[model samples]
Target: MIIDYSEQLIVQEVAPRDGLQIEPTWVETADKIALIDQLSHAGFSRIEAGSFVSPKAIPALRDGEQVFAGIRRRTGVIYVALVPNRKGAERALAAKADELNLVMSASQTHNRANMRMSCEASLAAFGDIVALARDVGGVTLNGTVATAFGCPFEGRIEEDRVMRLIDQYLDLGLDGITLADTTGMANPRQVDRMIMRALHRLTPASLTLHFHNTRGLGLANVLAAYEAGARRFDAALGGLGGCPFAPGASGNICTEDLVNLCDEMGIPTGIDLPLLIELSRTLPALLGHDVPGQVMKAGRNCDVHPVPEYVRGL
Candidate 1:
């Protein structure tokens, strides 16, 4: 199939929410705010700032409200918040979140485990949340199809189900839809097929692909999705997140790596790669561990090395 190589792509950084949610260590409120402030200057059009879920459910991010309020808001940047239900949506709106992201897993078993309810219940909750956002005024709504690619417990999810979810999301009057791999079970071929069909039903403006590097194919899937005319993506700084409820799930695709790949391929991502790398380098110190971003560690492909004196003499 023919590919589109010239369009600029969108990468929504989800490190603050998806990345930090599953961390065992609690990132300090000040550090979390500082991290998000640094990310805003990296030229991200959108950033998942935090979540409005119950603190008891995800204690690592228990200070979501504080984190969102403490951040230095920047113009031209949309700060997103993951809101689980009507209550969470109200909290997000009160916190002035630019966008409200609602999620439901494609796998029934995974949905019950992650959302603690049936798929029907999640949809019902979304309807209420969507109405609340509309009533609140000036807030955007985005629906996420978690485990859209595969589920650890249930295995493969039917593509028809995924397509139907997209339709339902549109019917609900949401602004965007994110198809999350959840556990990195997606391959390049599968991404192409799924994304192509997905693009057919909705504008690329409303479609975002969220992939993980658990199987080392996250970037490959991004390439496939881009080649198939899908332009938006969800990546985390340092590849720092996974589903707390999904067994064996790993982190999301690395933001620096994704931008580096786009830069290498002559694709414009509008993100500051060096600045992102600089921020990524700080993660290890802040989180007290190494990150999964290769570009942050190895530097970009354009980086030059100095020749040794012995080699010069030789």
Candidate 2:
């Protein structure tokens, strides 16, 4: 029987950046490097290896430079880094990141609280970072709209605000733009409507979805976006991430679970589910807490049950 599946989905593994940033205890540079290397070997084409934020702000990823420098650069894999400003962009470039992900929030209040700057200031900084990445870094630039769906302090963000930020990023000549539900308040209807609007103005090639499962609608939201023509997504191993600004924000959608969904639906994500589970199992020792990913603990659907001898006789 021939079964048709959706086109291949590009999964950008974001464990090192979004995953580690919220953790209280810092992961060693060696472990971070090893994790990146392992994910690369596991067939993830793009991996967000680290963020170049201030060590004081996110002590968990203080060794961003060392982590990027130490990773074994495998061919056919793109190493990406999240940069908040020109300084972070410079550091990421020095470490030879293949892609520079510059972030700005949609909500004014949340932007100030998270990045210590207003939305306008962060957007202005994005242009500078984009120029630097092109002129000096020789890297592709990606702009992210953090808290795109809703803000913890400010509540719902208007769709115009999200599109406006994306317009500014597009003006900067960035290769792509990612819309992140930093607080995970996005519903399928909202995602479908927003992404459809984005598609009308921008090519789907230049769009990416960064969803968190904080409100438990992450996978549904992804499906909504996919139906609206979005092919790229950002996920973390063991569903690791949360908002420091949002009181009860949860982890990003789990990579293994997403891959399982893709595999079942005949969508090509190019990620090894078993290897992702193995990678997720190490999180307890690394983060000192239980993660939210179910597939890592329960195993996949293909994990067959053993038949009893009496049943076998029948």
Residues 200-250 of candidate 2: C-alpha lDDT, one tens digit per residue: 767877799999998789899988888778889999999998877667667
C-alpha-based local distance difference test score of model 1: 0.92
Candidate models: Cα lDDT each: 0.92, 0.88
lDDT of 1 at 141: 90
Query: TM-score for every candidate vs. truth?
Result: 0.97, 0.95
Candidate 2: pairs in clash: none
Stretches of candidate 1 exceeding 4 Å from the true structure: 245-249
Off by over 4 Å in 2: 1-4, 308-314
- For candidate 2, give the lDDT: 0.88
Cα distance off (Å), candidate 2, residue 175: 1.2
